[model samples]
Target chain A: MTSSSVPKRSRSAMDASAAATQALYGASDPGLRIRSIVFRSALLLSMTVALIAIIGIISWAVVEGGQRLSLGLLTNNPSSFRPETAGYRPAILGSFQIIAGVIALIIPLGVGAALYLEQFANKQRWYNRAIELNIQNLAGVPSIVFGILGLAFIVRGPLDMGFIAAAGSATIALLVLPTVILASREAIKAVPPSLLEGAMALGVTRWQAVWKMVLPAAAPGMLTGIILAVARAIGEAAPLLLVGAATFVTFDPNFWEGGYSALPVMIYQYAGRPQDEFHVLAAAGVLVMLGLVVVVNSVAVWLRAKYERTW
Target chain B: MKELGKEKLMAESASTKEEVFSLDGVNVYYGDSLAVKDVSFPIYKNEITSLIGPSGCGKSTILRSLNRMNDLIPGARVEGDLQYHGADIYGSDIDPVQVRKIIGMVFQKPNPFPKSIYENVAFGPQTLGMKGNLDDIVEEALVGAALWDEVKDRLKDNAFGMSGGQQQRLCIARTIAVKPDVILMDEPCSALDPVSTYKIEDLMMKLKEDYTIVIVTHNMQQAARVADKTAFFTVSSNDEEGSRTGVLVEFDETGKIFSNPADQRTQDYVTGRFG
Candidate 1:
């Protein structure tokens, strides 16, 4: 009834309305557009800077030591007297043994600690809160502090494990243990709580539910963390120095006893030398260490992509 | 026709039916706050009891207490008597695991383990160490949930690959795999489409022949469609303290509650006037 009585807009009024609509949809503020562009460029610049630094180091190492990358570099033992024929057999073996020990130590201890904290510990309790805070703090502590701890407690004071590859392994394990635990806790926390409830609703005990459902679901993420932590342990030289990774270990290192020389430690030793040949050898060692870390990290990324649950 | 038959059966059994759960003056609390206060109701055996309410009305809390699922939450406590059969479910000697084995639950969301279809169903029977052929048990549970025909060809396929409704049905199959006497469904079809919801409703009707079901539903029509008895819950607020608590306003046969409710609040709720 009111529609018939309603007055229509004048021609000029309709034209002005169309003009206002045009103005509303025309363009964003120029200042806002410039601000967005600036923000994006800043992010791109930061990422490019990091990428360039990594590529620069890698390329420099290849240029300096490209010719020296041979089977002999892996086969022949290091010799200060003959840098031309020198290799890193003993150091490679030592690094392998130390890393093997580190893997054996960290996997069980770190995963168990993470499970206890994530699945069982009550956050309301003061002690559990304290433990959580302590772990986060430990991850931030310098790697060299763990070296000092390993030297004082493990090498000399309590366990009395002398200068051996086992000492180096234990030291490096301690250095990366916090990282493994933190990553594992994060992985466990990422698993949906609904899965746990679903399992428990079927009459399984909490432990059964965790072991059967939670662990398997979180396995890929936990493994990614473990692999990254192991990579970090492999590259450690500061902690191993205090734990007795000898500079010029001629023989292959034993796990429990005898002098050890990891790849990074050997690189550090060669880089410290005055001879130009040893410097080349050190650059070549850097390539080998970088290759090993790259391989381990690749496995972690592959495992994550292949198994991570989207739900 | 099916609805008429179900209603007829319900009316015939109204007098002779046994009570599966009897709650008297139950109060549920989370830490220092009382979430649900003085709720009393009876859930009959071999019947689908629907608890209908708006969000945050403690229907889910009361449902979780049936199988002691709330024990998983720290500082959550239940007071007063909740009797399952003749025994107190929260007795000092009663084990929560055992309680859950007999009274399984299906959650609001379909949460299947990241495993094969067969493995998801088999997990329950394997955990309980049930004496039977594992394959047969998995098949039976799947068939019971009305999913065997669709999933039989892909028993080994991962459960996550299925559609959302299929996944929810798989969850239901998982619950029934251990042969529980009672199943608590917490809005099992809330995440499903209309067709899937109808499929589940039909499945629930068939399941009540063997297992008792108590469902918490937000959909009033769903409660009227499949539930034999309906319990209406509403949130009550204290003006002085500004604290909200869920209270059971009415409980009766589904038809009566929807058609002619006793309480004004239940009338308001069922007619979509207020919640």
Candidate 2:
């Protein structure tokens, strides 16, 4: 009978242990229900902490940033060391110009490379496998290394185009291209095989099916990936620093000319000056850049939500 | 419409039942594995030929072999003569894409593209570049599939919104819209309800007036019910790494095949003796 009651006995034994432990600390004697509430409360507390950290950071930035945000802040170039004396206009313009250049560079190269890897190239061949391996490795390689490569190749060594905006754009674009290609490949591959077969069975040619049907269906997710890649490019500081983003240029620089500064580099320069005014100016610049990235990423997220396929 | 009427009138002559295609000593290989061995069969104009067999018996293989749908499978190689109206279909220069344009197919599951209902029927005709009256052609195809009355009000609605039977019929409409000479079906009714199956069965009888259809089914009664002719396929294996090689065990008029079969295997299968 005792052996048959093993499950009940063990359960009671656990309750006895609880009671014994309760006797050792008299005030801690709560029911299972109360203990469960405490356990869940701990989990909820951790979640609240996470929420607080995120909201607190955003709130702090937004509050500190409110005073400096104006048309002058958005549209005028920087003077020096003073919050009233400085604006992110040049940096904002430079960021826009850099983003446009990177987009132009990425679309054709990234999508074409992805298409070649997925559709045209035979994955079974060793050379193709080597090429695939190289791309994956390139995706993981640090952005600073890409900057070094860009400086040696594009800025001075072979091409020697000087410290131009085009050079900075190209360097950042190259840094993010592998990410675009990798993401686009995943989006393209995620299209159902049944969909491909359906198209093929309809007498549409393979190229027609891929272009007209498959590409359109997969485009939204791929665009989302492109947006994230562009976001990463804008936030990147190491590569742009080496590629020559100027610290305090008053006028808009051409793609061919000297010293172009972007948002991050401008913020870095102000933050390093060690004056209270410069620190406030740096925070304002940080807010502006964060806002721009949020707007851009919001657009991408909107597009993804609008066109996302259930299948 | 007039041309279709004339074609129908001409086909009324039984002597006009010319051979649409012929396969001579045909062998199908998927990579190194042989799927069909030394198979030969003739397809007649405007006939419903049902291929029946057990699972993995290559009934679908024989159906796909007719239009080279098997070419979609990488490393699939077909040897020996497969002829379409006395032309060498497997010749190096002959494009399988072109062969496919002339022969459409409906799959087991009713696979409609995730598009509007009107777009689904229009897809094939658009690809084939049919000239003049796109709206008319779409309507005719839908009506021919016996789906126009049900779907006429909501041509702009999504294809997936329709019932399973409607989707299958839409697939049929898509196939006929291309004006292909033949249509191959692979277990099309397997995913259908009994009522939908009957409707499609009736649709098949009407479609045979214009298109040559070759179907594969596991249901013996379906073969007995709708087919004008029947082909029985079977597979055999030995001890040493034996591959599945489908053989045409019997072929005859549908009524004859069901009522009085010449092959022992055919009788066993039809009478539900064993797979």
Candidate 3:
């Protein structure tokens, strides 16, 4: 048996040296059956659990918000409690207005800070170290702490902008600026230095190299970071609570004046109430809030895949 | 046999080319440690001059200093005068970028941008904001590097997909696109196969009719084949804190340096002694 097996084994081994060595572990191996089953089963289980959670939330929200999910939810102002009669129209518009201002403020400032830190600033010195340290510390600072600061500075003090949409946007921008700067820096740092030098070698100045090669390479990444930071700002309530978010508003407030109410601020106001009806409203508001976040983040993920550098 | 004409000598008129770049009493230092010491040589115009030395002997450093690539490194300093076109290259008014544009360099590694073949050639002219008929310039550069026919149809394709030799040629095309007066290459053929190396060597011979080519190479045979004048550099001082740097032991006609070098050190190195 040994002699018979040795000859057959050697013959098969020689014949299948390169091909079966890989194929055997892939489609040819019988031993991997159980492992494959387990691997696929685990993957299915995670996806199934996620789907179940999503379906459960949607069903619950629809059941509780059946009467309020119509054009009224999109058109009417927030209410203290009239159940089917109250609407989130003002809050929706206010949230969008705040987001616009936040985007306007963060795009230039965040990208500028990122470029300064990643490209121009010398990393080997104390001043740069201090700047890096401060940014990291700011990222972890509590949202409520930022709210109190916004209250003191923006709502009342020198900035005395009231609880206007612009004021809320400013507060949220400050809250998300650290995140945007950090993400933009990571994206910029990922751009190959060789590309920059290649451009500069051609006779293009340092600014042109960055504008033409480095920044474009980093664009898709920066866009994703902006989306995530914007999404986070959209969902913030603690900062908005102190600055000036009202529980009820029939009409959308203009940017610079009057009270504003974002989805989170409205959700918080409803959820904190003792009524069971208000709690149901809060859950429904959560679904609407989550939908907005998903849409924005989906666009970001799409853009990331679109321009993903192959080289 | 092709006779030498005034046009063939037209590019050789850097005055300093017959003596174009002169390094007199040049000492290169990286922080307090000297990397190259007492190196004196002349790079004639429109000639291929190769610096051959052992690895880490600072052969590349001398090449880099010619274009002030050393200025990029902190704590890197040079003592002694390096004159280009009979003017001080180390002068306060001389911008490194302008110097680099005039004296282009090709690294030992083939570093093509993640761009198309045509774009790679167009990069230099684009940087200089050269107007009108860029298509002509790109085509000329590709033809000059002898890569036009091979890459002509696929000029829009990414440059990274090409073979190492082709990529090196592309880099040469890039350097030449700007019409630099001198081209410094740091072991441009080290990463290429033999066939590719021959192609590049042939290209260098042709290019010498237009631009001065200064190269640093580890291949003694390559130097003998391609270079008109060869400078032999060797490691001399031996210690940690004061490690030996590359010294120019001999600089003459390539055949003379290989056959009848005057200095014993140069002879020992040329014949493969303690290189």
Best by TM-score: 1
What would the TM-scores of all predictions be?
Answer: 0.92, 0.86, 0.83
Q: Candidate 1, residues A221-251: lDDT per residue as tens digits?
A: 9999999999998898888899899558888
- The interface root-mean-square deviations, each candidate in sequence, come to 0.6, 1.4, 2.0
> What local lDDT score does residue A167 receive in model 3, on the 0 to 100 scale?
84
| Per-residue lDDT of model 2, residues A1-311, tens digit only | 55566698797898899899888887554597798999999999999999999788677767776677777887777877456767887777788888889999998899888878876787768898898889999999999998898899989898897778888989999999999999999988988766766777777887877777778778887898899899988888788888889557888867678788889988888888867777777778878878878988998999988988876
What lDDT is reached at residue B208 by model 3? 92
Pairs clashing within candidate 2: none
TM-score: model 3 vs. ground truth: 0.83
Which residue pairs collide, candidate 1?
A: none
Indicate which candidate wins on DockQ: 1
Q: What CA RMSD would you report for each candidate?
A: 8.4, 7.6, 6.9
lDDT of 1 by residue, B1-275 (tens): 22213233234344547887899999999998899999999999899999998888899999999999999999999999998875777888778888888899999999999999999999999988999999999999999999999999999999989998999999999999988888999999999999999999999999999989999999999999999999988999898998889999999999999999999988888888986
Docking class of 1: medium
Runs of candidate 1 with Cα error greater than 4 angstroms are A1-24, B1-15
Model 1 alpha-carbon miss at residue B5, Å: 35
Residue B239 C-alpha lDDT in model 2:
54
Candidate 1 TM-score over all chains jointly: 0.92
Interface RMSD of 3: 2.0
Q: What docking grade applies to model 2?
A: acceptable
The fnat scores of all predictions, in order, read 0.91, 0.48, 0.39
Off by over 4 Å in 2: A1-60, A63-66, A156-160, B1-14
